[model samples]
Target chain A: MTQLRKALRPSTKALPEYTRGHNRSLVLQTLYRDGRRSRADIARETGLTRVTVSALVAELIAEGLLVELGQREETRPGKPATLLDLDRSAFVIVGLDLSEHSVFTGALLDLDGAISTRVEVELAGSTGDEALAKVVDLAEQLVAAATAPVLGIGVGSPGVVDLGGVVLSAPNLGWNGLPLQALLAERFGVPVVVANDANAAILAEHSFGGAASDAMLVKIGHGVGAGLLLGGTPLFGSRFAAGEIGHVVVGTDGGAVCACGKRGCLETWLSIPNLHARLDRPENADARERDVVLREAGERLGIALAPVVGALDLGEVILSGPTDLLDGALASATVETLRNRTMAEFHGSVTLRMTALGPDIVLRGAAVMVLSSRLGVS
Target chain B: MTQLRKALRPSTKALPEYTRGHNRSLVLQTLYRDGRRSRADIARETGLTRVTVSALVAELIAEGLLVELGQREETRPGKPATLLDLDRSAFVIVGLDLSEHSVFTGALLDLDGAISTRVEVELAGSTGDEALAKVVDLAEQLVAAATAPVLGIGVGSPGVVDLGGVVLSAPNLGWNGLPLQALLAERFGVPVVVANDANAAILAEHSFGGAASDAMLVKIGHGVGAGLLLGGTPLFGSRFAAGEIGHVVVGTDGGAVCACGKRGCLETWLSIPNLHARLDRPENADARERDVVLREAGERLGIALAPVVGALDLGEVILSGPTDLLDGALASATVETLRNRTMAEFHGSVTLRMTALGPDIVLRGAAVMVLSSRLGVS
Candidate 1:
């Protein structure tokens, strides 16, 4: 009888703390997306009472997270309203990128997601605790370089990260169930957040790159993967593997073997190493042959993503990788194949393009993580 | 300059009215999921104050939506707590299913999602306004047959339905931009909700069929389409065509042409008519040959769904169609193909099965719609 009753518990309940936290996020998100606004404007826009807005804004300003920017320009207003905005330069955020093969990059970023200082350390094929140490060292360097109080440290690693920032596995880094965030927080005495590199890349795209809320960012680097942002929130899935599309078999006809032992996985067709290998083969010497190789890889990618775009009705697909490889032939072919494979009316409009943030996507995405977690603004 | 300011507007805001509606739904959802509970238990579970719970419960009971069900029998208690629950049978919901090729089904369902009475009308090749009339007639009959006061009417039609209950298109029924919900509401003088049949089917599976919160229901009768329930909320895409997967080309080897002018679409491989046609052919005379056809179709379905499963990390996929056709060979083949196509670790645990609701899925789903919208129960 007790078991039966226990089985009937609701999954989520709205506690007072939760509601307060939600409202804080709402306030910060409004300011982040809409720029500066007066307290009265915020109250009207968010449907909160003027008193509540005043209290929240006062608390934010006291915490050094918000700043008063004098009065708003008046046209037809009875009285001038004091404008409030995020203190973009009040604190520095330490961002770490552990996704590169030969280097680990770290940066100090402002609240506006602009890099203030950058540093790097050679990985030299380090693994396990060695790689972990390098990450900590790089983060420390970035922290030391910050001009203002450090807000938080955010790391974007190559693996399946849980809600607690535990990297379940990253075969290349020899990490499994590593408590990276807790270790960093203990060292830095600040809040720390960690996520998969692709996940972080999509956040960077969403927060600073002007991507749609309902979009997918396919990171095609050392190994292929994707990150999804649906309805302005990232989908972490039931097991934190929502965008693990690299190992999905894309080709019906047999192809080169994948590291996971799958013969025709999406990674086998679309990964950087594999794409370059196929293009550089002796048989594919001419420009037309190279185009065919890229087009075929793009078609395979389209085949894999068509169902996802159809199922979720995604608004766009952004490729975060080398423009020399993904732009032109491969990108156009992906769009063409997507148009053919999916329902034309519903999915034909799904935009496919390269990321504009360049190589610093993961670094910027890490800053977004820190901003969203420590300040409730993404 | 005006356009620039408008562009910066946040997509959503936490309005007080929205919060009140959310809290109301949270209270009802708690009772719906956890069965009978006292106002104190409700307050503790929802983190609302005792006064708020008492006021909400009083209002709900006064509205005939909830009922006081005597005191709890406690061994050690100073005062016995009064238990409360939904008035499950106080009002009836009229649910209509218009996906059948030859008939339209309607039912009078209690708040518990149990069918109290059922009715049907032959479509008989009707199209346009004639088909719409049959749907209205069916709904009218179900409303008339209700044993209690009507809560609302819900219609599960085949088409792209907008949030405004407009059917954007349904070629077989010749419906385009039809305000079916409004027309029905005008005639019946009740709140009406309309959605795609597949969408409704997924709701039934989530609310009463014991499906996971992150699951997909694939409807494969006259067409092959899917409905997604992510985090217990149905995903109606930007254009309300999130599950429009019928025209997605599933076969890379290129088999039969589809009605959508595509080759080897999911409809061609997995639709009931297509499957039956292939199985009944002279080439598939033997049972073993029939199994091959079923397995091939299932493989094609798996091919199309592998990316979706990988991208979303869905916990399960439920096939809502004829069990005799989808069970055994086809179902097992789908599971096997999915295993082969997706990553071994992340997607290996995804369950694939036939829905236990049998043929009344859409009818029950429509009831769920009414339950959710009118009383915020589902």
Candidate 2:
């Protein structure tokens, strides 16, 4: 038994080199999750040596980002251990969600993924310059309320967004070729990441909500859009217009015209505005009548989505936007249509769920985008 | 100076741990391309030590894959070094291109990616089981003729191919839910890989042909399909039907019905057979008249592909399969239509070129698929 143990052990005491950065990340994650722990306890939990753990802990403490919390009780040990934890008031991030009709801005963050502070402001105008001013003004308010240093800003818009923070096109917003990232960066004097609103919402759900696994989040509002998560990473197509399922033609004829100059688009009949328009007859002008229109719209939405659902074999489909408009009967009708159109083999196999982040999903996802890009954590 | 030289020398005599496998691959690739080299020559070119080169060469030779040639010219103050080269007869791979009309089988290759043998058989019936039997029989004949050990078999088909080797739906071939991989594997008692034909062609182009950069290859033969290569890896959508651009509607009305139960599909207007039917009068049929019809068909094909050409912003579009049908006039029309419909900014920016792989592209691609799968290179 002694010989076998000796044989199994490596001859040298030197640690493998590639695992250094990985071990550092693990230690940081552990400290973030557990608050504070003694060096010996960290070693046992992470399967790292005391010497390695002590070195990392000492380096972090020296950086002023983490601190030692004195000694802990010695339990069946020769010496007491020093406890360490992340300094919670280290940094904060700003999140912004820009839409055609509204602009939402907020800030809430922690090293271990917790909300510390949040603020939102309604936009009086939807012009490009006006929207930008509102975003900066709200960010300032959030910054004033924050106790931690502001790290960076993350903004989510509705359009074909490139990695460089440019909005190539946003039909609903009547914008074209806007350098959104450069504007935000110039305003705040910090790193800014701009992504599509639907893409950001999916990221939020994937990171913190029920649809956290490999899934697809479809945002149904003024225009239909989708964000795809494959293998835990967002998939951006060749031209960044990958998730524009709204333009896909589901009906051959008699479908409403779309803003894209195309007829019979999925967005034409399924969008909230279109549904409301269809239901605003003289006889059905009340809220109760509007509810009936919303339900019918959901049924049409499911029919349009059946091919996509069958094609991707996605595990979950998450919807977000105007909970009042997407109520129980509407959602149930959408599910029923989806069930009827999809292959029987996959019937009852996929889950259709609602967003958990409420109206703040896009904002939270924007914050998450900043946190992930700046700190290398998701 | 002596002390400095000693200090600069690596502490460990073995290859650097940082990129050992990568360096080994580089050496192997060099030999695969240049045929043979001496240890001193390899050291001079690869920046590797003579001792390290000698160790790898010895291991490869011992594995009965590499051969040691006679002594080469000596430039050092010592004896001449032996040259090493890969054994050309090490192994062989079978590539099969299964289409709706015919089946093409070929061997590619060892040392040189050249076809060793090839055979084409017309299918009496287009059933999955019948096609599988024909493939198995031909593969056995090739295996029996080969002097070297067979590595594996690769088949490229048209449809939604799963990683599990099932053909989900091949409408053109009247196939659905066919276990192609298992059928071939059980019959031949060898490893088999099934891939989408368009995807296979794209891989071939990316690895060996001129469309090596980030490009999209649209194979327009009996059917219209697209293969996208982004960052050198095939982009399979969440549901694996990502590049199904054939079904995208190009015409609003007065278009022929597609086999997929759709009207005015891009495929109905763009396919070779449909194009020929539209132009050729059966009463006035002749070889010269057939050429005219093919040329006219190419013109229509260009019109159908114009939107796709604009949407993806592809650097190059490669057309493969039956070049005789897609001659210069057809190509020019495609270029002309693409120029007119695409965004003005990208006008004359995209290059439309015929496939460099000839008629045997799909066959060659199938062989490459087998090689990559077995070697785990892709």
Candidate 3:
């Protein structure tokens, strides 16, 4: 921080307008965290006055963000109080993931995080403008199919993203300095968020996958990258490129050359194609043989993750990619290696698991971004 | 997050009492961040009412927390405004660091982070109750020599500290579940904080070292550990053992055994003793040979940090140890290795530097913890 910037920065918080919005967010967040509750229950949980809760609840109901589901079924109550819940299906999120190498995928997800509609467009040869067009089209299709009003659009694209949602560079998509947020916001007439794919994945894990509020997600597919969440929020570094781990050099000297001109880079050792080449699995390889190969890959991944686990004392490490490649022996190897590499004390408390969100992890992550930015629930 | 806990937790913030204290803290923090300024200037920067600023300023002045620095020379102004600054010498802080092995040290620091009194006690054979007594004695001696009102006491010990400042365990100090906070608070009749030594170093780096708000501090002594900061806050994971990086295995298999029964833990490779053993500098060794040995140590350290940097997208790696061992060739090697291991693009922005605060880094860190916990400055 520079002296000039420090001089300009405010020490006191904002006024009542900001506080009011925060209070409103608290009410909505309470509803999301704790399901169906009476007005009195909400007031007690929120520490808001009865009158304040009632007013906010009324406003939320008027905005279709909440609904009264009649009286609760209490056995020994003189008068059953009315229960309020989030109007889960009243709004839908349009989520897109462009991380996949050959296709652009999208979906419409309800407030409950369930996908209601899905669409995709092949991008095997599409580049630059065409690829951007494909993403816009898929999102448009999902928006058109939504049964309720769309909340906003959230995108998980492959590349270095700026704070303002511009794609600084996406080598595979041949994009550089694209103002994706402005373009999509203008086209859809809704707020839009564009972030790195792995970052989106970690958000999904925190928002819905029951992963620890503070966790780490390592996505190993055509490329390897990580997403870090600390204290329930994504750790976007000073440059907003905090989780780009693919090109880390793992060896002291030459083994295989990387596109980044570094020898023995982690990408050369862990990416899907690299692993496949190293394994040399025959078409008829048995399960045991496959496990051995996966174990090797997983061990390498763990070696890479040892310092990270030790440095952050992270509690969870989520693997997201092909289940066939990451689960079973591979996942076990990664966990065991992490246990051996970092302190044994951290082994028991730290969790290692494949993502429960399955193959649509990035798409669901997009939905989580919308939830965080649009509704402030995440 | 469990459903029952979610239901039980209150969603709203504390009432006006907490808000009032927070506002006062904001005002003090503004003075600290922006240097000397007028009440009107503080009010404008903090977005607080002039009346509120006046009331808070008057309270602080009465409390001896602020002092009028007279009028500023302003050529463009018709009348010069009076300046207010932190009463740096009005209060003194007692800080203790237990990171050293054979000795325990304590110091008294003023508001400007400068030490005034120094004290130490030999712990060659001290352990358990005796060691605790020595610590208490050292603190009392420092307190007795203070020239002003003692603000509080802070301890940076080696252990897994709980939120309440209980030492879960500090093997070297032979402490376990020691209620240090309550004990010291009772003895001194003032606030006290006990945290892991690395965590304290990180707080110091954040509070006064001009380090980036989000950064890491690596202290290599008898043990190797790191302290992490994210978004201006220390990254204390659930176990409060977030920065314990000493036992991270640097080797895939056994080369040497660790005290913790792990083979080739990071401590085995990076501790000062281990580095000296590896270098084995003959009395007549040439400078080039010594450079090679230091370079190798630095490269090894960098390899260990590769995944951490990649996983966190960290751009700064600060090394704290004997300058003779950590700077020049060794620091360059670590920087080069980090550059090679992580993204080359990140290499341009990443920083690798020695501690500018010198050997008292942890002691100053103790003072930082006092400031943060006692006054909520961090």
Candidate 4:
């Protein structure tokens, strides 16, 4: 144990190959994080010489990964320098989301995370292999529509996904030990990243949504789950199931049993159908009545989440669901309950908001996976 | 919010000063992680050329940080090469733990995390500034005993500690906003790191103890708190207050109130005194009686920890407290409860163990902070 622990310690990079990769990653990551930069800016930010930066830039430009965006004229500099930016339209990323209740959705996203083409296939009561086939069919349609080279395919499924691109378990899709990444990579001839849908949403939030360094996203729909981002990276636990919060038992008084055999689980209270049932949907309920019902559900979620907020000292919690239900009284109720329950130091500070990205979150998040893994740019 | 998020983005290291610092830290980290290696081997491992590695090794040797450890026999195609290793006795680090009940203890730790000298000043009716003064006195004694140059001071204090070394509300010692890091650094003329005691202990486990990449350390004593490690690093939140789990509410039918104004908080159940009180200690108790009492307390703790396990999918939960009370039946009950309450996927997989370092965990963890921040080696 001692020797193994010692051997697993981290080391730095300095070898020529390592340096080249590191420098290349540095330039791309810099542009991704800080947006477009002039050659001098890239060199200065990366601690690389102008010659090395220029050489890397030329290679990237030749490869169609980077493009010149005119020049940034400086008043106090010797000469104006041309700026380099990611060629957003030169390549496409196919992103798939399998968290939806009855749809297998896929979209073609460019370097900027903008969805250029989207395709969907209804599950139509499909399950298991049939559903998997539907997802592949949708992805293929999206891929065919993309004019640029597809860099990779990223799938955000509902399950425990490992770094090796295997789905350890997806109860919704009845997938266990599925080499979905390998399958997609083989069929599409591109790199693939398969992550939990909630985790994917977290990456998307970090990439585009207003996520702080430490943030959590809770998606409430057919099933309730969460994605955790701690210290600027996704928190994939020992089993790559770090953000699997849906089945956690919330209260002691037994309510509806969850699929996992847990009573009063978070999912039982927050899942859309369960929520509607709990609310006792009145016939043709008005906005006021619906707001009142949704608010109660949100409070239940907040009570369930108090421990998570207090334990992790998280800065924010973004809720994703139907906008009308999640953003109005429901969000307010959640914020109020969370504030009253958590430590006073965090009161009114743990911001709770509806996700801004809507249904496109997981899809864009999948694209983020490809960009990060393939280009080291996130 | 847009500009703020952009400003918070981490940028690549640049400038000559930063580059030199990065390279030096990389070499030291390599030695710390990979252990003894020839300059050529280090060059290859670090992606640095032989010339660069040789020069760095020479500089390190002159600084008494690295020492040649004889030469390797001809086991390869080329000539046998000399080996370089960290000079374990080259420098000393002062580690202090402020989480103990009655004393402020400090120790002189070598590069290999061995305790060379230990000193303690009992907090005999001391409070506030007097208690802070006693800690300084103890550290001074330990630092003076070191024959080697003191590298830095690392302190693991109870309460909310910020990155700037300020103790933000430590109720036990009546400390609030005490600039302990600056105070220690100024007095010692060395770098100083002050972290939450639990966080420091997590670092210690990662450094010397057998800790998985994703692990949690729960310290139960005068107070109950946890430290979380995700993806091989401490999960410090936006405010550097992650893993403050003591105040999280545990049970549904509330038992007692916590200091944080929360009812049935984990602290009410898991704190050492609370646990013993709840057990109603029997006189001349048999092993069976003790096991029953301890098991009850352990079960309570498990109930409190179920949400955490489910949310994060943690692989291990380490308990640091009185081994006599924590091990045996209590540990089993906690394990059982945790397994039963958490997802079935984690059944029999979540390991629960007592700290290998015992009460010295936070102290060693303090050394880990110095190793990581000052040397980038942990």
Candidate 5:
């Protein structure tokens, strides 16, 4: 024992202080990914012992985060096994989706990932402080109405967000270097996560909606953006500004000028506002003519995305936001354009589908953020 | 006992059957990621028992793949510990880098990740089968010359590589749909991993070179590509072709045609060959000298990457491949261009540096692939 202590000194010195917490998080994450399990099963999966699993489970249950579900049937002739699962009502999380036109706030439930008590507030003007205040106010109301302890808040915003929670530049909102996360955290007295809106949408789709765990979620609303998910995790580029497909120059000469002082950006051709402007001609455009124009706009969106699809070889492409604008003819035209432009081998390998979350996708993603943070899974 | 048996039954029944070898591989992976430690440390880190770690270590040591060192000192007032590490001389891995113009074959050491031997073979005007045969022959010779047991071989080729090791395309090499992995594996009597050259380069940079645990590795060789690393894991887009930045259209019209049949691709404007063609015209009286031309080329490269830098918020960019051909005026021009084009707030946020491994970055990445696959770390 004395020799063991001496021998372990070097390793112990090198060991990070956060190892214990990380280990616990790993256990919780494994359980979360795999669902209910016995102590022995957890031990086997995590490479821990039954004793360690028992101790951890006990600690978790004591914290009201987990619950034992009594004996489960055994195949072998042995002692009955104890099953453990996350306590469904142990905690709740708040998810807020802040868009240029509207704000959505909701509660993401524990265990089952259901959204409860959701509210949508439209923005009169796209002011940073005004939008933030609306979000905070809605959050307070939701928290007051909550039956379970609220763990944290996750806000999905459009634009470049730093790790410090500062919105560096959101062209749509005209926000730059705003300490959004800090302000929200101070107000709510809980941890706050600020993510790119498209990234959050991707997370929502991957976790609960139609996008697979490895899909790329592209949101073509008032703007064009993308969120890349690999192995159930969002891929944040070095500066946390990955998946900005809007600014990827699609045309160099004589294309619509972008708000970012660039010409021929995908957003210039694919954005809802741009499409609407093109279709809403006061000169002589009927409603039926407008529908044809919108359908053509969708075809253009597909043409713009075809190169990206061929290059990335992504199997799933999910579209979200303003379904009325992207329905029927528009959807089919987009698919046809993609099919025509992509490689023959990848003809049917890619699936383009509308988001299944209706209007609550972004909000659900925000809730997922809070849940992920509380559970230390992300 | 009956209750315990009943409870355990479901878990036991539901648990997927995994082999002992797989568990052993997981143990090795944990050690590789967390570094050297005692059996207790391995068990603690991996959630396995000390007994299991001990057994695996013993087996590995007996197999000459691991070495047990003397006891290490303990930080806590407990038992001293035994230290175990991978034996550097136990095994050798062959890495191949198949670029457009040249083919580099090398043997990389285990544990320390040093290059044991290297042979650069320029691609002759030959058929695909001939080139493959030459690679196999070279690998055979390297394996025969090595003092250690050959664990595996890893090949980095320019193409879309499927899980089945098929090279979907290699326009430069004139190869398509080649079953490289299976052929190499069969010929060498060991596991072989075939991956995209850019992906391998990123992997090498992430695991053993400049990108660190979290960074995006952008390879600006004959074509522009990106490799994303988030939380020490590579982000393979849904179809395993996520980093095809070369095909990203950078101009709207009147640009050089890309091999993908697209006009104004980033690669068309930024690749070395393209730069040489654009700038090196002996007949043109007003054309700048070679030095000035290279600088301008670098500026164009930076311009092409500015949007990516802004969008991804990348911390640093590592420049690989023929530094002599890419350094001086071109490099400085690139830096200046990046600084000027990116948002002012993001100015100086990204640092550009030469790859640490020089031209061998791809080969090193291939070696990393073998290490990761065998250890199951990444």
Candidate 6:
């Protein structure tokens, strides 16, 4: 380590503390991405001195964060080194999703982001304190059911959530200026993270669903919203309302009024309830009529997104909603509309697809929030 | 420093090289933002050790990057300390703006972002190799005219420029996959950066125009384009087409044709030539009629930008264009349309105003590119 420091010292002055934290994250990230490895192997992969790797590995093991996975099979005469890996099953993460139209869902997620247990509570038109009570109850149930120690808790709620985990507003849940993270942390005596549902979903798509770093995930559930991942960081915006595209009017030709008292808002066209209302009308009984309805909704969505796509030069657009509603005609229309609205030579092949994570995307994303905050190894 | 490190050591481990670079930038930024300061003052402001600050200052002064002013005059001081500042006049940056319709402009800029010399060359319908040659010739003139050592060269061109400074496509200039940066660097023997004019404009706005770290600058020239600065970093999209919103179809009710073979594109409604064509029509003679035309054009711009504003929750939208066309009625209409089209509660007060930099925004932005890349300061 000293020799390495000397060699690099000509251009780079050494500041030991920052390097240690960065290297620690690098070590965990390496194991998280590439699986188990011997200390020597980790050192080689990470370009860290073998001594440093050994010390870090030992410290991690002592903290119960890593497990010795026994020796590796060797063809040579030298004794095989003991393998080490993250203790993935040692702790459970509590994740809650409050973006659902009818129920609040909670889950026990392992470090691997796989759900070990699931629970849900019907909202039953709850609001304000009642809604807060239900969220607490659901979290309590998930915490009680965790098979291992709780690592942390993360909530993906519908609204503008600030960096400090305050839900600034969620009209559906009647939340305003709610310090959700602080409340949960005080009650559970653990770290807590809270974010917008769409934001959480984008993180899950990036971490688990193989989405690219610069991708936008549009969440079209009870409300229409989007989450942007640019250059590997989620944009929270100046007002913590990044991806709040639900109420932005789409297209010049106005349509039905939105809940926000606006005409032709994206939500009026893309929200599940609105889409159902438009498609299920008695006058639109034929399959061709339904196709047209979905296609129009898709076109509206494209209109709302085309400027964003062009402005950001985004390459991927992931739709997170009921696959039945967003697939086929609607999805195809969105692609066609985007291609027509934007410059073909510049954004000719922007990919638009449905997320495979299903409704659990927010839940998994919540887990990622906890993992990233608690261990910095998501 | 050791005591501070010990206090922070429990959670943060040290990595010398990364912290050194970070601290170097911190020092430069502190002096850049706060003006001249003593070593003690810099240490206090940046939380860096006096030893570290002294070493960095000495190194910077030796490199001709920092200047030490006379000792501070203080009534209470027993011994006054010398003040340090960036050597703002020691280097000149060459900036080129190629987004103009009929002319290419160049300037020599000091560290304070002040232009000391300016020059231009008429396009005269030049394209392809001829245009490239003109750009080289202009750069040579600026380099020769510099009164100080040339730091680097930055070009803000009208095209989809890749991260490697290659012009992927600029139909107006008939450039396709031209290695602009490499060619200029080889000819000038200095670092060269080439980016889309809009991207460069945004950088200028952030560094010199007092724009926020997370803001968008719309450059309306011969063509319409935008540059985004999110979280203090310029966003280069997956295909380097970020901020290519010029050709996005603004309204479903199509009107005039665009050069991209699209009708009612934002360019048709907001570009210099298009706006002039619509407003300068002989039959539309009255001021009210002119207001109506400009207002309608502004509404179209709002329609194109509302989705982007909502998606990113941007707070500031600075327009770079002819003030006569974008100000007053047009600017007001754009703001009004945005309010009507978006969630008023969330984006009610988004500021949309013309940039104060005028036509020189792209040129200054080009200088910022070189400043930020070469010195990690802007």
Q: DockQ winner among the candidates? A: 6
How many Å off is the CA of A272 in candidate 1? 0.9
C-alpha positional error of residue B154 in candidate 5 after TM-score superposition, expressed in Å = 2.7
lDDT of each: 0.86, 0.66, 0.80, 0.80, 0.69, 0.88
lDDT, ranked from best to worst: 6, 1, 4, 3, 5, 2
Best model number under TM-score: 6
lDDT of 2 by residue, B70-94 (tens): 8887677777778887676776767
lDDT of 3 at A204: 88
Instruction: Write model 2 residue lDDT over A274-325, tens digit each, in one string.
Output: 7667877777687787667777677666655554454344567788877777
Model 1 alpha-carbon drift over 4 Å, by segment: A1-19, A72-79, B1-19
TM-score of 2: 0.70
Error of 4 at B306 (Å): 1.9
Clashing pairs in 3: A249-B341
Runs off by more than 4 Å, candidate 3:
A1-17, A73-80, A251-255, A278-284, B1-18, B69-80, B251-254, B280-284
Every model's TM-score: 0.93, 0.70, 0.92, 0.89, 0.74, 0.96
True contacts kept of each: 0.46, 0.04, 0.43, 0.42, 0.29, 0.75
- C-alpha lDDT (0 to 100) for residue A229 of candidate 3: 86
Per-residue CA lDDT of model 3 for B1-378, tens digit only, reads 132122223344422222555677789889876669999899999887888788878877866778999999998958899999987777788999887888999999987678878998999878888988998899999989987777788898887888899988788778888988888888887778888888888778777787886678889888887888887788887677787788877644455787899787767777899888767758427788878878877877888887777777776878888898888988898888777677876545788898788878888888888777656564
- Which segments of model 6 are wrong by more than 4 Å? A1-10, B1-12
TM-score of chain B of 1: 0.93
Q: Which ten residues in a row have the lowest lDDT in candidate 3 chain A?
A: A1-10
Select the stronger candidate by lDDT from 4 and 6.
6
Task: Candidate 5: give its CA RMSD in angstroms.
Answer: 8.0
lDDT of candidate 4 over B216-250, digit per residue (tens): 89888977888988778787677767777777666
Winner by TM-score between candidate 5 and candidate 2: 5
Better model by lDDT: candidate 4 vs candidate 5: 4
Q: Write the per-residue lDDT of candidate 3 for residues A1-378, one digit (tens) a residue.
A: 132123223344422322545667788898888779999998898787888788778867867788999999989859999999988877788999899888888898887678878898999788899989998889889878977777888999887888788998888889989999889988987778999899999988887788786688999888888889887878888667687878876534355898788776767877888877766758427767777778876777787887777777788999998887678888898888888777765545678999989878888898888887766786
Could you tally the backbone clashes for each prediction?
A: 0, 0, 1, 5, 43, 13
